[model samples]
Target: MISGLLTGLSLIIAIGAQNAYVLKIGLHKKYVFPVCTICFLGDFLLIWCGVFGIGAIIQKFPIFLDTFRYGGAAFLFVYGLLSLKNFFKSSGSLVAGNTVSLPSLSKVLLTCLGFTFLNPHVYLDTMILLGSIASAYGEPGKYFFSMGACLGSFLWFYSLGYG
Candidate 1:
């Protein structure tokens, strides 16, 4: 369990599209709970799917991986362009007291989805790598390992989101 927790943390600690989005919205204090929930749930889904052999299934089709790669790249690119454009503009704070309105909840959630699922590397880490590691534990131990991993994911997302 400890090992799984460490492994999950090690994999997730790196800053990437998902984490960046979480941290950005967290700092801004906009839709933090929903964003964090989406991240944790996404991680939980991938981790469990990986433990159950989805990694092998996914690997069988390289085209699927390629599609996610290109699609994720495009997603990040567009987000970057939007950020750059907004940087020059005087969009007010997302805080409660601010006069400038927040973006629609639907749009923010959609962006969170892109950040969470569109990243192929996240699949590699959570599904493939973590799943492979858990399989080595065999039987019930694998379940324990997955539990620890899921707990780690839960902790990291909430901490980073609400910290």
Candidate 2:
């Protein structure tokens, strides 16, 4: 379980787009609750799926992963171009950034969901990586490991959100 906790933390602490976005919104004090909840839930569900059975199934047939990877790549490429355009259009100052109107709740929710699901690395981390590790623990041990990992994820996302 400790191994699972540490491994989960190690994987998540590597400052990905999700983490950076979480920190960005957190610092801005906008939609922090929904953002954190969605992210943790995303991790929770994926880790559970991986720990229980989806991980092995995915291992057996990697095509699903490949599909997600390719689709996510395309999505990310478009998202990156949009972000670049936004950056160029802005004055590149915090004050100017703040002048923009509040985005809708639905938009915030969807964006959070996108950050969770649109990134292929997330699947690899929660499903393939952590799932592979939990397998080493065997039945009952794997459950404990899964719980530990979930707890770690919960801690990390909430901390980043509230801190």
Per-model TM-score, in order, reads 0.88, 0.90
Q: lDDT tens string, model 1, 58-153? A: 779778778988998888888889878877896564343455545888988998998999987888888889999999999999889988898999
Error of 1 at 139 (Å): 1.0
Q: In model 1, where do residues sit more than 4 Å from their true spots?
A: 90-101
Q: What is the lDDT, from 0 to 100, of the residue 11 in candidate 2?
A: 91
Question: Would you list the C-alpha lDDT of every candidate in the order shown?
Answer: 0.87, 0.85
Deviation from truth (RMSD, Å), model 1: 2.4
Give every collision pair in model 1.
Answer: none
Candidate with top lDDT is 1
Q: Which ten residues in a row have the lowest lDDT in candidate 1?
A: 93-102
